[model samples]
Target chain A: MSDEIAILGAGMHPWGKWGHNFVQYGVAAAREALADAGVPWQDIKFVSGGATIRCGYPGFVAGATFAQALGWQGAEVNTSYAACASGSQALAAARNKILSGECDVALVVGADTTPKGFLAPAGGYRPEDPDWVRFYLGITNPTYFALYARRRIDLYGDTLEDFAAVKVKNSLVGSKNPRARYRKCFTAEDVAASAMVADPLRLMDICATSDGGAALIVSSLEYARKLGKPNAPRVAAISTVTPTFASGVLEMPDIATDSAAASGVEAHAYRSMIPLKAYEEAGIGPEDISLAEVYDLSTALELDWIEDLQLAPRGESAGLLRAGDTALGGKIPVNVSGGLACFGEAVPAQALSQICELTWQLRGEAGDRQVEGAQVGITANQGLFGHGSSVIVKK
Target chain B: MSAKPLAPAIEGWHTMQVKPHLIGSQCTECGTYFFPKQNDYCRNPHCNSTNFREVELSRTGKVWSYTNACYKPPAPFVAADPFVPYAIAGVQLETEQMVILGQVIEGLTVDDLKVGMPMELVLEALHETDDDIKVTWKWQPLTQ
Candidate 1:
């Protein structure tokens, strides 16, 4: 309804370890999306890729890879990598082109064949890279996440049950998703009994790495009408914003905090503000959002996302989960498509895939676990190295 | 040995944070801050002013969270052996209102740690060679 681009089609290769090349998955997803959109690949004026650093050389130039896989038409190609937010950045790139009238139809794709266990930085040692510094120092990813979980326990009085409940709520929804990697239901007991990956978080609490792909066909508002569906799912806003140093949020793969000794401004920490900004630009608030798909790399992280998304007040996300406010049948369902808790993380592709879930929800196409009467939806995720992202979609 | 500029200590060399802790830039007109210290300019889209200053963080804070590295980290991290258990701690500085993460000192395990425990940052040797020793700050329990 607002002046926004239209998501004519959304498609994803089943999210699992397919044991094939990332390009193959990306091509399959792209073809499905193009077919769904009723648009020919040759008509796509621009192509942007959410990169997969996991793929070595071919992953770096994902835009060209997908372009070549689809048969080279010389469309404008760009590949972006923002750790977890790569897919959202790709969506932003495509949307920007359409909004600026530089292109009418754009193809956006993100796919990855992730490594098993803890994701590590690319090979070699150079003290200069913070990621390498942290890893070399034996600072693993879960350790940082545990650090965040611990802080919540200290300052906010959160408990182990609160953390477990996040897995409970998400697992319930994840069981309904056929595309999910682990579709079994979980309980607080199950989470409590799971082996500790980090203090206060267990292996069940963490999302697994996966090999999967997701793609979308975005077009100008005028183009959507020309393609016959005047009322298609529209992308209201795409925000790929990062956090401010004043936030006091020390990110991972870094050895030190931003020196606050010089700047006296107490960091107004808002890593979750970007997504809300996108919602605001879309002229909607959390209450107005019928459902949501958020990054759930860890169960505790998902609760943090709930607070960060402003879906619930600070320190109250757990209560909302207990109240069934964020469950599939709740007033404002979250992760109705099982989120990353079920989907298994595909890295660069995950955030864009969240949008794909939103597109499905907003279009009233989500089977089994759909949020009833869904209208407005949002996808929220953060990428490492200062990438903050959110997207608002409305039917 | 004195600091011999160490093997580019962790690799893919270029920028490294040494004595001065990294901080980001913010727009006074519009509230926006960036870390890894945004050297380019203020990131707030609403305001374009580049009036920003550096801020040093607290050396001491409380442990917000922690986890041990049970698996050997992959490339770029120079390790002599396979994955050994190492602890990572997240510290929350009261003044900054942000949580920072780092490696716990060697020999420290989760059983020895608890949330809300006090921690202080200290620069310790990460790796050492004949000529240079790579030193980086890690979180250590105040009592330890």
Candidate 2:
């Protein structure tokens, strides 16, 4: 019951393409976080940064890079690269530092100035890399999303209308989010009229990549008391885990799977386990979650997360949508922050920014889209190459 | 790129190396199994244990889904040619309540694949690079 870390400050550099360096966005967000925390930059004891794939450098050392941008005060620094989960991982690293007494107060930042057009492979196309294979095979991210969407249709008997409903829900919420990249509400008819990005999936269904940054300042309970804000929002868990190799189901960004001839470990398919692990670590189950902020990389994915997160029975997510079980007034409000559908995917900054939304929702700061009487909130997101996942539970 | 026939990894084949076989996870909890084994941890939300054992997948499974690559794959994928059509599919395991994806072996055109058609897993020797023979796994419809 005593396991709690204070979320002293939360900040963002908005979510859009402004043609600025990623470090600038991160530093700006971090500075706002420090300011929000009512603490000086020199008072921060540690810095953790979520990584971004950068030119020349395989990974942008956000921790040290942002540290330098903010002027080094000799703070302990760390960097994490779990794709979209990078933000949560950065927050986790900072949390551990505070929990372990390695640091009393920490700064966590995530930012990305993504490339224009389709998120192509980083330069050279290596056939061995799944990311490259999917691209070269002409299997765009939308295509994989389509596969899952199609599967839902075939196996779960979902309809294209169900998919459109997802867009309608998230867009409605996103329209109210000032930090969201896409602020316009969309109707199911609008979704039906959109161009097809992949078979059965329209352009409106998929989330676009953008440039944005988000930051959070976390401190120990004692540190929060010293700052005069005795009651602060907390981060319960950060689940950035990988899939098991079993039957080696081919995940996105991968062509062939691990040969059953090799390691022989039973694969823990992510769709089923990833969210559960975070809930387990938080000592709460789906029934206890009051609200959720999930990675809706695609509209269909939001429905998938509904089942995967056990918000609804398997294959019943679409029905839940039709019945308004997941809407703002439903049993569990998901992605009340507008989600990726309206916010767009800002890659490295996505998952971390998701937690920022959770912080706001849990603290009853979400004005229009807030879940009524919200007590606990969760954030779910997955990144490429077994890189990211974050499930933050806050009350 | 030349059409080099895919060779099995078994002995007496044109290429060397044990056929790369598809692998997956078998649950001790409910007898459920999966390909691309869930090694990180047991996934069954109903089960709490992460204890999982690696098992060689069934050599044969039914075709659950199929698709064709109409364009050249990116670097690292062994494609020196452009617009070469290749067939791939999701194969359903008999024992595992899961489906695995792989390229259909050479000579087996997409026309030869059908959903629910029985297929067998095979190790396709990808390419010979000096001392190492890179191999991968594929699925082929069983001869009726």
Candidate 3:
């Protein structure tokens, strides 16, 4: 009678610039997930794919493309795209199907082959497009990350050392992760020595874009019980919410914040709002969370997410980092799969990759990166524009 | 070719004044402002009023935050040769109560500004097209 659905299995293709076709990675991860779930491809009643804009035409129609690539079995297909939140949205779609009595089992997959260096906007004098506008203004992706990272310094007295420490901690833990792309431990000096892309953020302070894939097999609780997965981890909540009006934080791809000049309307922090709904639906507070996976697009961003997740007090996340509370075996450890710090970003495949780490940790299969007795885990990410998501999983 | 005329980069986003103001549209009913001027509709969640009036945004604001770009951006950015790094600021306009982002005037860096510092808009050469110098609005520290 629970509203939660079962996470039957999780799998991933090692994240890196392998440079093969994205579909090949998707098939590999999908087959691995099916094998992990012990569910036949034909038994998958639904194919929910996180869409990739980089993979050419096939990426746009990802659900059917993946379905066809896996050998079509007449399964219902759905594809969801919300920039970086694509995987969470795809998982939300699968969860909806199961909870709505539409399907028993679903395969959720995402993969990408990204271009090296800065993800540039398309050409031409299109000033109307926000992406184009920002780029035209010399506001590259690191510009946004740097602004946020700089704010931490101005507001909280955070220092470059604290920022470097985040990279150091994530790199150390991520080194243990076989699936992580950058397993080499990064030191504060290494971070400081890197080229400065944006002030207060060195090249090491920012995450890289890499090619990778990840997948999950989710089923209705009833189907899980029938399959003898009664003890499997459950998808307790998924929140893919758009920002309320007057988004004050100046999200990426925008030239300005929503004007709060209108009387009686207020500017809202989009990142903080993403996880509140997930907590409400899961019937739990931050205290119940054992670990978290957040989008650390930049190292300082990990501190921002820790606060947004309410794991640490506002302006106190760096203190938590200093005290080791956010490291493995520490209180409410975050990004134990090394996070984007180690994995880099695979875009569509990245969010589900967080869920995969949670599934493994909850099942006590996380190897050395496991948080002891993890009962609940949360993942939070802010996609471009108005899209963002936070998902909660429980054992 | 050097005598080619200078023009607004994207056209009409800002004026050519020494103390320039970015052009935006305010929802007539809600008084909510939008940069690049949203003339089609209003975005105030409480009101669905479609009427909007083009208005000049506040000329000065406080720096909500700031940073600098150290690498050359890809076109259509049209960076200068040698790619001198330039500071960028997120200035919070008092009347609009919205933060607007723009590049800082040439030769300034993050070291030159801080959160809550006052800033004003100015016209600057964004990039030079073969046809003309494409200009854009940039933020300038009032202290400068």
Candidate 4:
């Protein structure tokens, strides 16, 4: 349908700690996307970029920062910060602009150069801030991840092996992805041997924070047709939804979940709502999705997201994995781009990177890891402070 | 020579007494409870009740899940010098059915806890400055 916004180009600056500024990575990805689209920088009518809080002032003004870096052609600029979901929010903004005819073609970019060691709160002692409060209470990100992982094991009968298998499967695919940060394939033994960061989650079970970037050039279908590329992959739906009140799910940066006793919980919890909303908007269901990419901040989270994506019945993701249903050639191959398991997390850039991989797979350009006859794909991610996003794309 | 007196890291969290209980807010109309006290308004989407009453949470709850920090968390989180790993748990209160996260009592590890185990709330020192001791709530397995 004409409702789709065409993804004319997708690009990334390899995922790793290069010790360079975030702008350099963003600019490199943007130039590659521009080149791939055969659309000159001056032709871009709008730009939406994700903000990285760690980069000081420039990170906050990412849209203008990237536009100026690419040689300001006077493009309209917008910046978004939804934590890890910032990239999806940026893409959603660009898609809306294209659909509304405010811009025929728009550039979307997200990049981050994370700090070394565990992610720390920005300087300041604001006791009222939940992020700071959690940190002060010794509630690290991995601590929360482990809480959920352990819950899955208790509730779903999932085992340590099931969690390790995810690392093994994703790392194998990551080994083939030159852009991924950790290329070496890992065995379950290797994952087990890694030091435990959080109980039930070993070092390898969690994704590392790294420096990387991803960019996309999107346009209206009519604009794509005018450019002589009629069959480009198009984003059918983008869901950037906040949690319903009294969300029972415990998310990051929050010390307690919303009280379900007051509002009465919805059928879908916070995490499940993102992709379900996208599916409804796309006029499709789980059965229609050819493949999926989801936020795998931890190995157990990947399995949890699989159920949230409705690819498997609740609490049965481990069964799906054991049966080889989520492998490369299995039903609904997930994280074919190696996910955060391999690429690590570049915060703002990570979600957009998922879309980049989907764009290539939908266009039949993914060489070794290509899902044969792939048509529809979905990307799901959740950011701290109640931001959840999902995007559906089709060829 | 005496050590400094202990204080709640953030005030109004709990009472410092023989039996310490977490102080929170309950929506008088909807009957939903919020820990860390939502003093402003009720979070219930279904009801627009601005009226809330402060209530002390149940002393005991079931463990929803638990984990331990094997590495020292970065700043803003004040860990002991020569950091020691600590355990954290999500305990679902008996009445509220809402899960609240807190550090487990000293010397307790993930191995000592299990999902659905009964736990009681207690006050523990989070860290200490030269002049004052910062205290926060912790979860402890109820002794039989």
Chain A TM-scores, candidates in order: 0.95, 0.94, 0.99, 0.98
Candidate 1 Cα outliers beyond 4 Å, as residue runs: A263-266, B1-60, B75-86, B92-100, B105-116, B121-138
Q: lDDT tens digits, residues A1-395, model 3?
A: 37899999898999999989888888999999999999999999999998999879999988898999999889999999988999999999999899999999999999999987677888988978999999988998888888899999999999999999989989998999999999999888899999998898999999999999999999999999999999999999999877788887877988798989888986568788888889999999999999999999999999999998888889999999998988998887988999898998989899999999999999999998989999999999879985689999999
Best by TM-score: 3
Error of 2 at A138 (Å): 3.8
Over A249-306, each residue of candidate 4 has an lDDT whose tens digit, in order, gives: 6678889877777545563466888887899989999999999999999999999999
| Clashing residue pairs for model 4 | none
DockQ of 2: 0.13
Instruction: Write the residue-wise lDDT of candidate 1 on A1-395 in tens digits.
Output: 43699999988888887789999889988988999899999999999998887778889999988998899997999998888888888888888898888999999998999766566666654555777666766766676677677767766777888878778878787788777777889888998888887666788888888988899999998999999977889989888765654445656656445534334344444457686678778988877888878877788787788888888888778778778888889877888888888888888778878888888887888888888998998888877754568888988
Winning model by DockQ:
3
Worst 10 residues of 2 chain B by lDDT: B8-17
Q: Which number leads on lDDT? A: 3
How many clashes does each candidate structure show, in the order listed? 33, 48, 0, 0
DockQ of 1: 0.32
TM-score of each: 0.84, 0.79, 0.98, 0.97
Model 3, stretches more than 4 Å misplaced? B1-3
What's the CA error at residue A63 for candidate 3, in Å?
A: 0.9
Global lDDT of each model? 0.76, 0.73, 0.91, 0.90
Candidate no. 2 TM-score = 0.79
Model 4 TM-score relative to the real fold: 0.97
lDDT tens digits, residues B1-144, model 1? 465765434332212444324343444544444343454565343446767655445567887667786655655455645545667787777655456777788889877778778987766666667777766557788754
DockQ of 4: 0.74
